[model samples]
Target: MAKDKKYRKKKLGSYPLASVVFSVTLALFVMGLFGLLIITTQNLTQLIQENIEVQVFLQKNLSENEVVKITKILSSKDYVNKKAGVPQLALITKEEAAETFIAETGEDFVEFLGDNPLRDVITVKISPDFQATENLAEIKKEIGFIRGVYEVTYIENLVHSINKNVKKISYVLIGFTVILLFTVVILINNTIKLALFSQRFLIRSMQLVGATSSFIRKPFLSRASMFGLTSGVLASALLWGLLQLVSSEVEGMMELLHLEQLLILGGSLLLVGLLVGFMSTFAAIKKYMKMSLDELY
Candidate 1:
């Protein structure tokens, strides 16, 4: 019977170590998942931003000098930051525009025209943030009102739809992140509790020996804090590894994940681990504190 009791004591003594390992592993997994979410959303945003375009039709009578002037004016606008702070404007000369249409339709009517009927067109790429259909329409109206612009064509409906869809996707991502966070908290709490459980009897024994509740709680809190700190480091390491792997396969992804963002993410994970470990330790101690010796047996 004494040997059996000794074995039980040994098992209980090792519980905190096992719990700490479990908490750290779980934290690492959660951090990796959050990193993936950040990377994917950033890539999607960039892809959508690059696809928004605007086309400006020049007046039929406008000369090459006039077209160049308009291009310069448009390039100076504040919204041109979509592409390296330079406006994505392409000056399609009348001849080139005609050739493009002819090539697309394979039309042989080049010889029948009195002159190149196509006007000089300036193509503009808009930023994704301004892609709301109504907003884009207002912008089109504004552009159309320009003195030399014959027409401004932008797919307002398409841009509005894209914005709406992107908003919905963002909401879904937020919901999933919340769920993931809660799941991580619960898993960490349980793992830490199991680790603290081993010390419950020791805590009770101390209580019988007239150890103050605060005194009994000190060692557990210290151990739990250590576990929390270690888990946070583990999470950070995991996040770094996952981001490295993702960067290897995707170009320009490092731009989205700045040091500030990574620090915020790591800080949150660490805070979570600390809170879980402390709360679990406190709860375990309280449970044993209120128990009778018979109850413990």
Candidate 2:
């Protein structure tokens, strides 16, 4: 009787606690990685959209007052990008345009033609929400109608291509995200279920001794919840360390990391870990409790 009781005690105490924690932490870490990728993709998209600029060519020989008036009008429009509470509008003089062209092309067209053919321009950066191709077309038409405006032009093909590629990339990322989340849930569930398998006979003995279902479940549920919470914290800490390492090693990576989104992702990982651990443990215990004594063999 003493040997049998000692063996049971050993069995109950020897549950693979380290393996369970390691498995849960690994699963949570993978999910966190996917979350970071999604956040980075969104930040990249916003950066690209914000960089899209529209060039407004002014008619040659406009008076200084007319130029000032046109700039003020463009600046006041809602379609223009605003940064630091200032409109993203800049005036490029004909001489400045000529210099830029000469520097880029390595040929002085003004000197060759004996005249500067470049027009004064006002470059306006469109807000991200208005950076779509169709919206840009409408903006160009509206601005082209203004008096003293020679033309409104931009890189139409570039914008269209970027929009098309970004759409495809977004679709791929979303699909990958869904698949990864499903995988994480399954992996975590299986890990917890297997961990509880060793406790089945112990649970059965408790049931045979007249322990209430709630009483039997309470200890297991509490431990599983703690396991999950600890795993999540460990996983999150590792992820944060990884982020810091990447940001320090890779140029421009910090620009793409969104703090608010990352915080939300970390919280979500913790919630997922806690729920999966608790539910899997409860299910496993219930299954053992319902089995006959002979089933324990």
RMSD vs true structure, all candidates:
4.5, 2.9
For residues 1-297, write the lDDT of model 2, one tens digit per residue: 999977855553235678988999999998998888888988998888888899999998899999999999999999999999899989999999888888999999988999998899999999978878889999999999889999999999999998898899899998998898889888988988887777888887777798789987888888788888899998999999999999889999978987887888889888998999899888888888888878866
Cα lDDT tens digits for candidate 1, 1-297: 999978766642345465576656676557556756766686767677676878899888876677778888888765543455667878888889778888999885566776777778888887666666776777787778776899888776777777878788888888887787777777777777666656668777677789898887887787777778788878777778877998999898787666876777788777877877788778877887898878877
Tell me each candidate's TM-score.
0.77, 0.89
Question: Candidate 2 has what TM-score?
Answer: 0.89
- What candidate 1 gets wrong by more than 4 Å, as runs, is 1-15, 63-65, 68-118, 249-256, 294-297
Candidate 1 clashing pairs?
none
Superposed by TM-score, candidate 2 places the C-alpha of residue 132 at a distance from the truth, in angstroms, of 3.0
Q: What are the Cα lDDT values of the candidates?
A: 0.75, 0.88
- Which regions of candidate 2 deviate over 4 angstroms? 1-14, 101-113
Among these predicted structures, which one has the highest lDDT?
A: 2
Evaluated against the true structure, the overall lDDT of model 2 is 0.88
Give the distance in Å from residue 251's predicted Cα in candidate 1 to where it truly belongs: 5.2
Lowest-sum lDDT 10-residue window in model 2: 8-17
